[model samples]
Target: MLSKASTARVVIDLDVPGPAISRHLYGHFAEHLGRCIYGGFYVGEDSELPNEGGIRLDVVEALRALAIPNLRWPGGCFADEYHWQDGIGPKADRPSMVNTHWGNVEENNHFGTHEFLALCELLGAEPYVNGNVGSGTVREMSEWVEYLTRDGDSPMVRLRKANGRDEPWRVPFWGIGNEAWGCGGNQRAEAYADLARQYATFLKDHGDNKLYKIAAGAGDDDLRWTEALLKAVSCLGCGREPKNIFQAISFHYYTVAGTWEHKGSATDFGLDDYYRTIAKAQDIERVIRAHSSLMDAYDPERKIGLVLDEWGTWWDVEPGTNPGFLYQQNAMRDALVASVHFDVFHRHAERLVMANIAQTVNVLQAMLLTDADSGALVRTPTYHVFEMNKGHHDAVSVPVHVIERPEAYAVDDHAMELVSASASVKDGRGLVSLSNLDPEAGLEVILDLRGVEVQGVVGRLLTASSPQAHNTPASLGAVAPVELPVNPASRGTLAVTLPPHSFATVTLTL
Candidate 1:
């Protein structure tokens, strides 16, 4: 621990009491891709496993605990070819189709629209459905909304009544399409933006749906696509542009070993690989800045939102598992990446509205992995970051300034800080969240809390025994968080030593 400089006053503004932040940013995505749905979230009706409406009960219970804010369904590239109608009605009578993108496996239309929305209900999560635009028509997309959210007597409305849902499910957020740059049809940005206006106009007409249509956007950190989409969509009309047209502008980024095509091994990697992957993961801030700058230039009031719809670490599949399944082990590395993303999002919370990780179960960077055969399930280390950061959700972003020794990672032309922190005050409690990304060297942080101590403080640490340590179904509790011992509260300052490659949080209720 280092010596205290001055007692810096820490202030928290509770008037920033925003609508309890939607937990969806800390949400999960589930696609028919890999075993995310059929074998992951769903257990067959005939199976011996315990299930509610053929959906795995254990997986549901695990996800429910995480308080999954929102669950994105039928996505990645899978949403491109998905037909809402094929998934409704009698299970046996439904036609089976091939999942062209994921595993090249057959997808029985059994666990369709109704089942997905039902699962969201069981987990107490809001439904965020991705509409098919690459292969499906405007009419098709509109009808899906009507079927899921429209009531009364129309063709789509009548179908919803017959499909066992007499009332609308209140599906709030809708993706106009998924990844239009590549697997999602690869349309040029200008063309996609033009199509976005038309699709949003049609889908927005559904009664009481009030669907917040998210336009399909740039892949990874491509700022050009963000600029093109913003410019094109803004030209719709003065009142119809940034402020009214699109509710959110989504960007997708997956941090892996190398290039877009050949992602390296997921499980068996070294520390260098781990550091490099996270270094790349942290580049999302640059992408957000580029997009935000462009949006600010056009609409300084900042009406349109930024959404990180697809994110997380993509690596080679686990041994004895299908590569397409994205079935990799979750470790401290994944947890740190999750922490990095949340910290970045908090910095951009005003503009970065909603974010859903790549997937929930048995997919790339999943929060929960399930094995139905053994009735086994484990919450990934990434899950801990979400649990730890739940305190910051929807809370005001209190400004934090770091003046102590600041180390930087040096590359050819860029550098990122080794110490990062953000603070927020909620319920009259001051919470300081810190992330130390240095691979080595513990940081001696001198916290100045002058004129802010009325009571006590709490500290929780999420540090791994070894960088390579991971949690499996058997050792699910291995890489958990620990409470650090604290000395008596100082008059106005406290000294704390943070271990390398870790994330920690401190709370002060004054």
Candidate 2:
């Protein structure tokens, strides 16, 4: 039988200061795919469901609860095919087109730029717009930015006013294209970089709305893509300008347990699959390190930020949903994945300015799932993981050193410490987030607090009966967070036991 107990030691020092974890690190992505837009966020202004100007009330409430910092929208691949004109104007006059990249369903163009910006306003999140670089022209993208950000009486501005939105919306983050290595254009790095510059040239800033242009970066560990794109942009020779034309470069990575064609089921996995997924999730650090090294070589001062614009687990489509919809059930495995990734992000918070999980709703590793027919929504285990980790947003990183571990969890000759953790200080307190990756063993962690006085500690944990435990519309509370009793600090050490396949967050008043 496998060992049932694991021991780990964490050492946190208060004097050492690290990067300020950008709240944008907790950002979300909303693609015009699956039910993410229509059934998930938009229920139509006339629908019977509770809504605020066509946006789902429950979904907005949940996102607001997390204090979601930013939202990227309009496409993953759809941005390339999307015409800004098609999504503006009266809903009755708007055109419908086939979403060839996702489901091949007809997109009525109802939930267009206006709807997305309105939703962002509702949730109080920043809007990150991905412009079309594949099938769209410089003029189209330029005018789209003008329509949204320009308050002057230009043609686009007039059109915006005619559509009932008089004032311009501030869109600070803009993508030249998404996945130029694949979906956006299927172009080589050098070629896409050239197109990105051309499009970004005309995407001008209006008033105080300065655009943070993001170049389409590599997919996974493709270092060549990073080198070529950054080199191409560096050749621009912006002699006296303080800012690079591309304010940031994006990277996309998705964790898949099996082959892309036959990724294993979301909820039907055994210990082997579970271990493999954890191993895959751990690759984020290596990917970031490798790509960051390349960024350092080209732009040493780190003027351009690395945006992990798209990420999360992409498993087999949940049993019967439309395969193209990319829908899946998020379970305990997903919660662990979230914890592991957030820890990695926190450690590298300096260079990595922003990241958006693959999707925000009714899709890959979604925080919330909405029933199409019933309009009922369920918060997945991943959602609670975000909730529990929210304290780290905009907080200063408190360096955590894992002092020792009793044993390693090994699978197929690869081993990982049973407990993964990170620490940060916000305001006057300290926040520590931990995850126990061992499927069958609970981890007892003894934290050695040095250079600080701990007045008190409170804990919250998210765990379930099994790795497959998840929430559905019929059972919304299966994977929610509960208060975990905190052990009193004794002689500068605090002890806590993490249940198997669990995540916990402890806040210390210092």
Candidate 3:
């Protein structure tokens, strides 16, 4: 009864050359879109929930617990339409508008610059603001940076004083624009690159926080856009290395539930869709490979970081929630995707310096989703995945090759696999984490270590009875991580049965 599928043989050697991996890739995104702000992050001043200056204490505590290193802010497309001015000074006086792109819901400028930066402070996260390069003026973008960072006397600085923030808050990381090829204003790569240069130069040095100025990169798999940006730098007659002009080149890829237009529901989708999403999530590796190779040809020193600022599973919104809100129920499939993603990032940690799961809370693939009306918190499947992979964050990534029969599966226009794993040696230990996709079939494989010898395996597994299971607020334990055994059945190999569909981490003592 699929016994071979459960036989896992692995080998290890103590001494091996390792790759130095970056730590900052364990990052997250916080947008002003929909409930990502209001109900998700900030519960307002008068609510029964414990809060600080309108931010939820529970949310803050949870984010801190996640150890989120960096956080991108204020928008997806909202930044392009945002005037940082509207979010400063007074909340009652802040202007409001209908978020035309997302549900036409009213966006009261209440949760403005101060509220966001404050949230960042509570979480100890560096702020990455996306500027309005498409719709707003050069002066507006520049002033916003000055207001947040400049200590010297200036109108913007004075405005900061008037707004009750005496000390300058260093908003370090900045994106020159959002999706210039799309919502941030659809323009030719050449046109947007020139525009990016202008806004970046204008938002120049503010003594404390030197603006990072990340340029909008190619959409998923669109390499021409990246190439065009590399060539278009000369357009800014006052030239610099395109790499030097921007600290990072931002690329975005969302694992859509179906097609982008009608992304399928987060829950209730069939097994085919689940396998397809996992397969697509695996493509992020290829996306980074293609983009990194192009950038390498241009700047081999790897000066410019590839920032995957916007990513995560984008399934259909939950029923009754505003579709514009982009809320979706999380599942073990998402947890598996998260585990797979950590492995992908661990593989390319040097070049891919930072990445943010599409959002932090209550929106697409959130970590902590709250039922605001009920004052409840449901840890998403993605949350469990993050918790499982936390060990790989700042560790040295080691390569682990998979050799097995039940590997790659061909489906429709995409291909998926039953297994994905990454090994790393950090601090004083070796870590091997994996996610198996075949729900009905457990996996049997060998992890061969050429010369390195590891003593034992300490592992944990997040598994469920079925692929379609989920955790509602009332019933939270539909799926969860359980500790696995440490005993090795063989001398030079490891044998363990992976659950139907699960995410597990195996630690080897060197």
Provide the RMSD of all predictions against the true structure, rounded to 1 decimal.
3.1, 2.2, 2.7
User: Per-residue alpha-carbon lDDT of model 3 for 245-341, expressed as tens digits?
Assistant: 6677888988875887888877787878887888888888999999988877766666678888888888878887787788888888788778877
Considering every candidate listed, which one attains the maximal lDDT?
2
Ranking by TM-score: 2, 3, 1
For each candidate, what is the lDDT? 0.78, 0.89, 0.79
Clashes in candidate 2: how many? Answer: 0
lDDT for 199 in candidate 3 is 75
Model 2 CA deviation exceeding 4 Å by range: 1-5, 235-243
Q: How well is each residue in 136-163 modelled by candidate 1, as lDDT tens digits?
A: 9999998888788876788988888887
- Pairwise lDDT winner, candidates 1 and 3: 3
In candidate 1 the C-alpha lDDT for residue 400 amounts to 59
Candidate 2 vs 3: which has more TM-score: 2
Ten-residue segment with the worst summed lDDT in candidate 3? Answer: 234-243
Runs of candidate 3 with Cα error greater than 4 angstroms are 5-19, 233-243, 445-457
